[model samples]
Target: MSLIEIILVGIGLSMDAVAVSMSNGMVYGTLPRRKWPLAPLFFGLFQGLMPLLGFFTGTLFAKYIDCYAELLILLILGFIGGKMIYDGFKGDKEKAEERVLSLKLIFFQAVATSIDAFAVGIGFCAINVNIFFASSLIAATTFILSSLSFCIGRKFGDLLGNKAEIFGGTILVILAIKAIL
Candidate 1:
């Protein structure tokens, strides 16, 4: 994939992390500056690692699915994006005070958010893309976006929280459709 496409995919994939980071910001907005790094560090690490895990897993079956690579990418991205939009509209409010950003929470959130990327990794294998570069771009974009999301949430509250997810989802869906076409 080209760098632009990789970056777009990264942005699309990071929506879940971004939403979670925003929630974290709302919860931990009062923390001291020194402890602030914890949120981003946890988020960035997980975001970075998930794609690598996916890439390795995808590599194992790369040969078997080479012909249907683009279709697979489209399906995965579309499914993830559609789910996010559906969830956002479901209007299930997570109690702000009840949520905690513990290790387990971070790990689960990271995995949940990046599951689609794992499928994308499978597509990468089929397309013969460089796993290292794709994963690196994904990680970097996710880190930056996640960090910015936290900051934005801190400054603006949840005003844009749902909207961000919707936008991200739309982007992913569009990309998926484009890939398929």
Candidate 2:
């Protein structure tokens, strides 16, 4: 793909990550105060890296992964989305502050959101583009979009109050479902 095309793909690919990051912002209350940078950082890191890894290894590994990729994405994202939905519905407020945003949660969100990029890498094997340039643009675009979306989502979430978490969780679940179909 051309540079513009690559950039467009990056933006298109990042929509889910953007939504999740925004949800992260929306549900920021459940998380700790000091970890402000965590949302965009994790999203951006995985967004950038997954495609690169996929491009490098996809040709050799695609068949092995194709069989299980959808299932894995469904499970991981479903579990996380389910937990968020469950957490949003609970009555206790104290537990809310203590739980959520676990390392495992972060890891899963990162990987789950970036699965499309992995697929893109698989497609890249058939093309003759500059891998580094494409990957870098993709990563940078995701970072910028994810970061901005998180900030905006957080602001809106704050306005929406407690229901924001539920909404965020719902968004995740929807995205997860969309990924598989």
Candidate 3:
């Protein structure tokens, strides 16, 4: 994949993390500045790591699924993006605010958000892309977007509110469609 494509994929993959970060910001808007590092650190680490895991898995099984790799990427991206959009519009907004940022919660959120990147790693094998560069770009983009999401949520909590999730979801779905086309 070209650098632009890789970056687009990263942005698409980071939507979930962004939404989650926004939710965190809304809930913990009053948290002390000292604790700020925890959220981004945990988020960035997982966002970066998951794609590497996926890449290794893809490398192991590359020979078996080489022909269908593009289709697989489209399917995975579409599904993830569609799901995010659906969840954004349909999920319980009240519960989102109530969610606590415990270790277990963070871990689950990280894993859930990063699963698509794992699939993307599998796609990378088919396209003969540099896994290190692609994965790094994905992780870095996710980190920046997620961190910004938190700030946006905190600043516009009352006005943007739950609508941010809807916007994020829309972005994911659009990217997925673009990937397929």
Note the residue pairs that clash in candidate 3: none
Candidate 3 clashes: the total is 0
Task: Give the TM-score of each candidate.
Answer: 0.61, 0.90, 0.64
Tens digit per residue, CA lDDT, model 3, 1-181:
7999988988888876787677556555555677655666666777778777777886675455544544554555455446555655766866556544567656655765665666677776677888888888888888888888887766764565566455544554554455446
Give the candidates in order of lDDT, highest first: 2, 3, 1
TM-score winner, 1 or 2: 2
Q: Which tens-of-lDDT digit does each residue in 7-110 have in candidate 1? A: 99888878767866765565445455666566666666666666676677867755555446457656765776686567557545663233344666555556
Sliding window of 10 residues with minimal summed lDDT for model 2: 28-37
lDDT of 2 by residue, 55-145 (tens): 8896788877777777777887777777778888883677556656666777788888887788788788789978788888888898899
Task: Evaluate residue 86 in candidate 3 and report its C-alpha lDDT on the 0 to 100 scale.
Answer: 66
Provide the lDDT at 68 for model 3.
58
Compared with the true structure, all predictions reach lDDT values of 0.65, 0.80, 0.67
* Alpha-carbon runs more than 4 Å astray in model 1: 59-100, 158-181
Candidate 2 similarity to native, TM-score: 0.90
Give stretches of model 3 more than 4 Å off. Answer: 59-100, 158-181
Tell me how far the alpha carbon of residue 105 in candidate 2 is from the true structure, in angstroms, after superposition: 1.7
